[model samples]
Target: MVLAAPLAPAAPASRAPAAAPASVGGVSAAEWTIRWWRWTRSFPDGLEPYLDRDGRRCAMGQDDDGPVWFLAGTDGRFDARRRCRVPAGKHLLVPVINMYFHGPRLGENAMSCAQVKRRAAVNNDYLVSAVVLLDGKPLARPERLISRCFDPQAERDDAGPDDRRGVVRAAADGYWLLLPPLAPGPHRLSVGANYGNPDDPDYGRMLQNFEYELQVGDPAI
Candidate 1:
């Protein structure tokens, strides 16, 4: 993987655009849903992802000030760095690493939290790679925070309001990359992935690469 030159992301637009559409590059999220019906209904929640008209991918849920931007590619196409603010302490890092496929389809493909680290990584053509630097140093990889990564429809009936707090959007990129509680300080997170393969005769699409600058200290409002 090529190391992207460090850069800062632009501030988010004042007007919040609606959620991502069904197409990334040229692949249609809608068509993907119909073709992969068994899994699409529940995973990536069958919803379209956000896209940039100029062929650029933006971070989902991330604010120029802080949090995260959803649905960006993981192939380093997104060379700009992003900013995210979070309260000091333990928090999960949920990232969407691929551009072509969505994941964590519970019940159907054995997508339970028990399998995310292994199954979710390879199944459904999903690929994810991430690097987290806290206070300029790498921290130990935390346990996979799977249960917290979820969307509606596949939502467990027994889940309460508390469990729903961590609910991710219904898109293909809605998988979690666990990060242990962060110390009160500034940090950097780099993520990369290949959605599938563009040259393959069958099943080909774009990929993703994203970076984030985090300020973890302030308390969650």
Candidate 2:
């Protein structure tokens, strides 16, 4: 009987009202939007031997074209209207050393099936096998193709190196085996092409093989 009259029904516990959404500059929360932009550069020159000041053969000028692949997402898909452009006066060098599909256009690094098919018609006699390496370690042996994205061809330099030590190939698709996770430091990439016919005018050669000093972890483009 000493229960203090059942605590007066717990006094009907009070509750707080929900907060309204935030707004910016008189715009409603639902109408607010954000915009971003990026700039990049690329290189067309292949890595090859060059003469130094002392007239000796040496490899130099190894640098990367700024950010190559740019991925953007709002939820997870790309937002096309929020686009970016390359900044003016920005000259990008070859940042990563890997076999890339290059077309006639300056910034046309990735090629389409039609473009590769046309090129294959002229240079169809040989194949190029690329054994990609990062920090002197093997990554993948992506097969090189003729103009066709999936038509695998023979090597351009068969007798030069037997170990497949520097071989690079193109895939049937217009994609190259890209070296992965290049650190922010000095790095070197070597390629060996097996051109099946030495006397053929379309014989392949390891053109771009050099080291580049990269500034990794930089903000994305």
Candidate 3:
């Protein structure tokens, strides 16, 4: 009997990243992140896409009548690869490393929208690096893609009534990308980001890294 040599794993296929429009469906990339957050918080605990291990739950909280499809980053524990089927002619909204904050901490009476916005912005302050790739080509100036929004009326159906005396003030900040509709075919999307000062002794942690193997066409095909 002859013994065979061990085979090495192959990398994912690559192509140059396609050019994406500044805004799609009249929504800027910044606004899309807020919309993504609203969509994200709409789901109950186990059903939210951010906590999904595989791509099975990718379609969980999506609207059947929307112009954009939202992709999620994992819970930052490990790298996740998701196999998703995206409908043709739909723009893709991806969250690289985003943060949402709302509060009156433990003993506080109230928190303003500006206070919430500042708290949320802290998570992105020490960003070590963030990247978004199509195929394998990296997007330019990812640091410049930062967005911040304060929503005074933000509410989550799954989370019951607002805890802050009906104020419902909250904020979100992070790096977000809005990609134009891709051609109908198989394509690869990669998104990742890490925050915290590298000089700190405990700074090796990463926020999220996701790999999506997407089929842009009918699933029955």
Candidate 4:
């Protein structure tokens, strides 16, 4: 059987009780949603407030490689997409996963905030992994750079609210990864999701697994 591989080592257990309802956590899923929403709204200028094609809130940045995108979907949907065009050299890749599905309508896997927090704190249960390949050989692992939170110290004050540097959370309630440089070519990138609590009503309802093909540096791609 395939096991979930986390980029970072397991974090300490969250203070919230395990297996409790979404509302039982120290911060309810709904409440966290509202908090995240308000925080995102106050984003400073040039923070590039916008939704990805899939409706997830995201910001844009740049490294020595090229453009970098960060997704922090308030709804926990965490869906986004873009055109295929690999940079000339190594680039950073950040993938976002909001385990606390927050929205007007609760999703099947919408469980107690504590459970979500636990998933973030102890990611062995819920994880998002990626595999990058060029010419049929693996190039990157999900562990290149992973985090459970977007902004732990609220570093937006120091880095500017719109800066991508402060967008990481300290807890495991969410997942983010900064991958190493990927070679330019016909690369195959796959992002897979396996999240949820078997004891919860929404178990197995939130799992996702998919792949994409990118013709790097190719104008016709």
Candidate 5:
């Protein structure tokens, strides 16, 4: 009997990990909720003593304290015992440190500190990337790049062009790029994605023209 043509190999099936029980410091599939209230008694002047409730303050400068308390929670997949307590379901808590920033320009916004710390506490995974450009032009390669993440509230700092928190690459057509780790939510991207020849005064000037606004989340694009 004539043999039929060889059958094509079957495609492998995709599989998702099983949901884990919620714990105080581990990974779990259950959704966790965190409730926080401002300590009005201790912070009578509001979140920032220097800035008014309306988020307006003197340009000269003002004094303010960092985040009040940091809450730590887990999903019971990794470290079972940690600060805070939880039941058999997913558990979430606000970090003891305030990692958000609310100001005249910053507004009430959450930063990566809360997202990364919580994910790590629950054994979750996250990623960050950057897009570089010069004078609005994409680059082929970039030189001198750095990235890192921190609590803007605690640091009392603004995300600047030089801060190491995203990807940075050099371009062949005169554009430098930077991409950084980000969680679901609205994010502000600032880039110094260009370099100038030392002999050319136009060098580094393109940096002033670098700026971008983006949002990332469940429906990330």
Candidate 6:
């Protein structure tokens, strides 16, 4: 009789718990979304995490001293697969899909708080689905992660010369997830979302599918 070869071990299950804490490291989930956006815009064009094709730029805007790390979604209607190495013990903030509006920029009229909120919410109103998976296990109650309309101050660096800054009016709303620290090993995370009426291609349609293969420990290992 021929001897059978041993199969490889299965990858460990790394998932975001059903219920996230009220806050992580002194910051609320909602505020974390704002900070996530700021971090996304902190860098210039070539270094924006959202535009990073592969995960090499994952550390572009990271604060060396922060407790949480931010991940990005594609600009619009684009899919990206990335592999990254994250430090162990750091929480991960993922923006499943989100929208924001800041104004009084060049050639633009001032927008009221209500207007900003309304504009920011238009894309989300047509959301068809938003799915997040960690290690192939979906997160429970993804709708619970939706954020209410609120203003987020725009720092000087978060805006351009044509855009207003320093607490300028802004509003954002979308689905966001705060994943707790992962075990010091390999993990997989993916986000998929669809917005707009499929039948009408011109109706501000936006679709995104982002995949992240993460290693939550020293890459040298």
Best by lDDT: 6
lDDT of 6 by residue, 1-221 (tens): 01111121211235344566568889778777767777776787667788877888887667657778888888764578888888887888888767777654223576656667676777776666666778877674344343333334453334442234453566667777777788998988877766664554443466667898898886421
Candidates ranked by TM-score, best first? 6, 3, 4, 1, 2, 5
Query: Which scores better on lDDT, 1 or 5?
Result: 1
Give one digit per residue, the lDDT tens place, for model 2 in 1-221.
Answer: 01112112211213221122233235322111110011111212331222111212111222134223221111111111121222222222211112223243223365554664455343323333323233454434432322222212222324332212222222222213322234443443332223233544432322222222233444323
TM-score of each predicted structure versus truth: 0.40, 0.31, 0.75, 0.41, 0.19, 0.77
Candidate 2 segments whose C-alpha is farther than 4 A from its true place: 1-118, 121-125, 143-175, 179-186, 202-208, 218-221
> What lDDT is reached at residue 66 by model 4?
27
Off by over 4 Å in 5: 1-180, 192-205, 218-221
Of the candidates numbered 5 and 6, which has the greater lDDT value?
6
Give all candidates' CA lDDT scores: 0.36, 0.26, 0.65, 0.36, 0.23, 0.66
Error of 2 at 194 (Å): 4.2
lDDT of 4 by residue, 71-184 (tens): 232222333333354445433333334343221113464344334345544433444343332334443333312222234435223543222343222333444334434556
* Per-residue C-alpha lDDT of model 3 across residues 1-221, encoded as one tens digit per residue: 01111121211225243455677778667766767877777778767788776788877667556778998986667678888888887888887776777765335666765677776776566665565667666664242344343343463333432333334556677766667788999888876667764543432344667788889875511
lDDT value, residue 121 of candidate 5: 28
> lDDT tens string, model 5, 1-221?
11111121211223221122233233111111111212211243433321222112211121112111122211111121111111112111221111212212222542344344332222111101122222243323222211123322222225542233332211111111222223444433322222222433422212221222333333211
Provide the clash count, candidate 2: 36
Highest TM-score among the candidates is held by which one? 6
Q: Write the per-residue lDDT of candidate 1 for residues 71-170, one digit (tens) a residue.
A: 2233334444555556654333334332222343534543434333233333233222333333444333212222223344542435642323323323
Give the distance in Å from residue 83's predicted Cα in candidate 6 to where it truly belongs: 0.8
